[model samples]
Target chain A: MAVTRPGGPVDGSSPDAVSIAVPERASTGPVVARALRLLEAFSDERPTLTLSEISRRSGVPLSTAHRLVAALETWGAVERDPAGRYQVGLRLWEVGALAPRGPGLRERALPYLEDLCAVTRENVQLAVREDDEIVYVERLAGTQAVGVHIRVGGRWAMTATGVGLVLLAHAPPDVVERVLEGPFTRHTPWTLTDPARIRETLAAVRTRGYAVSERQITSDATSVAAPVRDATGEVVAALSVVAHHGNPPVSVLAPLVRTSAGGVSHALAAGRRPRRPR
Target chain B: MAVTRPGGPVDGSSPDAVSIAVPERASTGPVVARALRLLEAFSDERPTLTLSEISRRSGVPLSTAHRLVAALETWGAVERDPAGRYQVGLRLWEVGALAPRGPGLRERALPYLEDLCAVTRENVQLAVREDDEIVYVERLAGTQAVGVHIRVGGRWAMTATGVGLVLLAHAPPDVVERVLEGPFTRHTPWTLTDPARIRETLAAVRTRGYAVSERQITSDATSVAAPVRDATGEVVAALSVVAHHGNPPVSVLAPLVRTSAGGVSHALAAGRRPRRPR
Candidate 1:
């Protein structure tokens, strides 16, 4: 949850070396940047698309999308399906596994995450904060667990889900204020919409060391979550468990979430965490 | 996997488009290709690197590495770590999740994968064949279980792991022949390097509907695996459970792997399989 990349140099120069050539103000200078955005347009909801579809989604012209997508395919960033639609490529996945905030975080929390699912027989999830939303990195589903739409690398509002709340509670004040400013997606009647109520819930999470969310993302689910910290004591992620509503009090799940979170923290500090070998 | 891309149009372009782009090969084509190669230099083991390290590893000149890293960072394929080293970026991971053989496979197998972990309390893994190697798509750890270094999106030799054996068994004959003919990586004393012995193991896996690898990768661990099929009844993935070598009888874990693999096959056929939502 703590990962944030500062803007770096745009030209191929030293970190301290500024660009001298005329800066292209129109955002069309680097071919690679355009290529990445085209790839980004394909998300969990829209993993496959036709040529024109990608062009429209990425706001690149058909000619440019053609060129960029070709470059991407050469590097194995984009692949085509049997239906001749394009999706992300395996090569990109191989490289993405190197990202510390994504698979790196998942590797560390996995054992404890599994234990939480086994002990509670509920859906266990791990997420990191990206901007104002939380991106799920890993999840373990119980056979009888309630349905959830969240997927690994999928995004959800920071005010609705249990992991989102825990991460947001520990987020900076500016981020909290930004989320309180509106455009919340309402999934169930129980989902908090009032900024004041969410503020109170954040304070409660800080006081109790966990967050309880009832039917916030789905009508039949309840979630409990706790913050996971790194070696420097910074909250880096959140571990959560979602179960069927009315099955047990959210308080029953608090201990499992907290213990798993602490276990993940210890694993991270011990450097025995799961990681894709280089 | 018979998933090779044609050499002409690296993008999702028609053959006609390839004919039109023949002239540009004389110009700055190396820049884009070199940049892609630079990004490829980062891996699970070498997640962070300095400028000279990247140049040395990618075999690109210092100026080229400088230019390419700048292009990558501008496009968010890479980012600078706090200590001024370069690391893979989150944007890359987001796009990588679109790989049909990577997270795409994991999404469909996650529920069944979780069940396998819960019932066995052993390390559960889901993997697909990538070239001659097995690329792990998902791995669910067990609490107090045997320790392992495998993580999601990691790769291992086809002759050295239970999942690898299942995949090699179901692969086309040519794929099998190619693997057996090449030099193999032997991780431990139990790793099968002799072509004849590996052929016998593959045959056994096919006949029994499961695979048992004893201390193949690690001396203290044993793994049992089964094949997962798609609607076409093609062996698209393999599921495995790694445990302490002497803890569970191979006979006991065999049925567990088959049963779980069966559930996953049924789910895939139904098209309602639980997966990462993307």
Candidate 2:
């Protein structure tokens, strides 16, 4: 699993990229970072953990984990279930929902995404590039649509999905190079593994104003994706609809996806306001 | 503004209830708790803040705030924007989305929520009780529907909204009592301020299996809400739809709201799995 910090370099030296690279070695950062490491231990695979399990996974001492967990529990950053296992808390989610690049983007794109889902009756997704990876901000599963492995807040590689290709197309050159230098995992027989071929796909996404992923993630599904630009015309996100392959040609879905993406872009542009620097 | 900790008490002592009652005095809890206080400083009103602003709001010294912010930035719990102001990071949202009482519940209930929104063509919301307050987990705005002040991850008093009434009706006695002890801020002239009336409303909610908040939050809008239960029959969340008042009487909306709530309850019951006690 490649750890990519989404919003480019946080500082001049890109301290986030460095810290995420070596998460287990705790001697380099402050106590707060060590406590945050405990949070990182809980993921989709492991949503809940006991104190000792948290300590083991976070590489913190049992006593330290206990104290930190207590603090987290007190602040509503974490909570204990009926069986005394700690999980992320709703308060933390409320705070996290304020993230401009995450729920904020999802909130704005949701109506258009809903429209797409309603019209196509297919899986509609909105995603953004985080480092070299794609983080799904919102995924609306159509009632009659094929099942997808993607979930809100889930991450995927840049080489395997339509939204990923659209995002990678507009990403920085360094980000593209870093993604291309990958130990890419193939999900299906049609999954592209060659960097040259992936690069060509990205170019096509930029040229055609949309990307079509044919049975790349699963043998039964295909995705059509378009870029969502911000007020500054930067491709901040990608909107896509995944349907059962061969039922509707890519051309059939392309215009709808592009129009939906354009709606989101226009909304973003209209809603863009000057942020007052503190 | 009132500060409420959602999700009841995590510890036997219920330190969260006490700590949130006084968020400014940070000298009382662990260092990690103090650090989380900084996060509490960022809200819908002030989504981004400078280090000095955080220090001022959280009552942490400038140096301590700097160190903790850096730690948060390194761990992607917080990020500095282009103007050197700190905001909640996408990584935090990803972790927070794993909260069962938050996004987990929302994820299971979304399809039904969408259905409710599509059928009603009104604003639909899903929320859970966090202590004595309501934390909106998801909200879908209907096209051509009346504007709503609520946003995803936003909070409201348990006495003023339909979802809040449903959640409060099923809340523990202590939680209810604590909420009634409040100096409730009236959003509109119709907003209930008397504790006795609010208590009666809660009782009605429990009896009827639904709640109708008429012109409480806004003079022109009405909300009908019902409780969503988990596998153990615990009312873990509330579902509601806000519409223009008088157009659809509360009776007309109650059955639809209740049906949507039942759908989510059934989904949750079906998805329930035995947990491994840690």
Candidate 3:
């Protein structure tokens, strides 16, 4: 029986998450790729897994899974639980903390994100683009903030959320054209699936230096977002605040979001090594 | 001419940083271990490195270093920059976010941590014990807080900092014994290196439900700490606030730290899977 997944891996379905474009492996690259794929088998929902479960989920044989897991455990990437199941290790987290776009960015933006969450009592988010999707770097939730389903490192479509739109709007022209072409998944009735409407939204974001996404995920929520720039003025990230729609006008929220984004931009510019664009 | 190599494989005469005890490895495990050793070559002072630099510092053969770096790059544990230097990658950081002792604990405690930082404007820290060393998981810096040279993932002795003392106080008896018997490193004149004094401090922390470490690391700074418990009431982590020793007396800071610790403990207990003892 086909089962539903929260952040499902591609089995030719669930186009809302990151697309799996399996790279051709004629090199040792595929072994490393397969090893990482095995790690992806364990998530926030199923943080611990048995050998068979890992093999089944990753499409690797039981023996292959065992060997890979053993290698990972030895390298301190994966760890074994008392129940003989495997979970992500502390060592992996340590190395991952060094990721420039992940915790490295979160460290600088956190205080400003905290301020945004406090002043508005809303859900504040920081995100960067990864391939065709957006990955949340930091998420700050106020005590009374609307519940958000997004988690750090969780991926979402570039068409759905406020941070996503701000990032997508600032992405290279080719990236914009590619995302505008097709395969947009609708999350709610208000999700902008029409390429023309999305195009208009992107244009507005670029012109006004902010984006407002209304009820894209849930009918009760609206998001206001602004771009965070680096020293060279490249939009390295997007900062956003999501709150209940109709309670406060987007115009009232735009200045706060823009100010927070500016704070993050200044912090990034001050702390990071000079960015030589790829 | 070999300039005095800092952080090299050689043992040092200085008594500051602990001597790295690298196990003799003649096997594949050692090869992997050596590769990881290269990662230790990067520090807070130097977050990026060149290939030749890594080889020289790690004391690995150029070819071996290249092979291992290839493997690390393939796994997305590291990435090369336009300058041909390597830096940590976001994929690794994503996996690191799953670490229960690190981001897992931080994510749960962040809201409470923010509250503490907001109310007190003091430097708040969260730490866990790794062996006998205290590894800071989160540190929220308040604008006017006393300057403390601690960073996330940075390590300190279990005898000095407030969070360190709280963790050391609750550690297993054998771990305590090892620390007490140690040729302890001293930071300031006021640091408590005497085993009996440490014992008394631990007893006080247990009895009084909080710890006040005064002038341990810096002469101008004092820290107030409290233990954070899981659902089973076992001490899982420690939360502390660092401030100038004079104002905001330890007595005042004690209650704030304890209250924030309680809030974090509640949030941790409410999680789907409370962290099991490591």
Q: List candidate 3 segments past 4 Å from native.
A: A1-32, A80-85, A111-121, A142-147, A173-182, A196-200, A270-278, B1-38, B81-84, B111-121, B142-144, B181-183, B196-200, B203-209, B246-263, B270-278
Q: Write the per-residue lDDT of candidate 3 for residues B1-278, one digit (tens) a residue.
A: 11123211112223332333221111223334555666766665666789888888888656556766777787767787545788776767776777777777887897789899999998899998877888889888886799887778878898888998899889999999999997787889999989999999999999999989999888999999999998778898999999998679987899999999999999877867543211
DockQ of the candidate models in sequence? 0.26, 0.26, 0.17
lDDT, candidate 2, at B121:
89
Ranking by lDDT: 2, 1, 3
Candidate 3 colliding pairs: A93-B96, A96-B92, A96-B93
Question: Of 1 and 2, which scores higher on TM-score?
Answer: 2
Question: To one decimal place, how large is model 1's interface RMSD in Å?
Answer: 10.5
TM-score of chain B of each: 0.85, 0.86, 0.85
Considering summed lDDT, which 10 consecutive residues are worst modelled in model 3 chain A? A1-10
Clashing pairs in 1: A1-A236, A70-B11, A278-B44, A278-B45, B107-B275, B107-B276, B108-B275
Number of the predicted model whose TM-score against the real structure is largest: 2
Per-residue C-alpha lDDT of model 1 across residues A72-168, encoded as one tens digit per residue? 7777778786568888887789889889888888867877887888888888999988778888898888766888888777788989999999999
Off by over 4 Å in 2: A1-28, A271-278, B1-29, B118-121, B142-147, B271-278
lDDT of 2 by residue, B1-278 (tens): 12324311111122222212221112113446667888988987787898999999998767656766776887888987656789999999999988988888877887899899999888899999898799889888876477688777888898899999999899999998999999889889999999999988998988999999999978899999999998889898999999899777888889999999999999999965333111
Question: By TM-score, how accurate is candidate 3?
Answer: 0.78
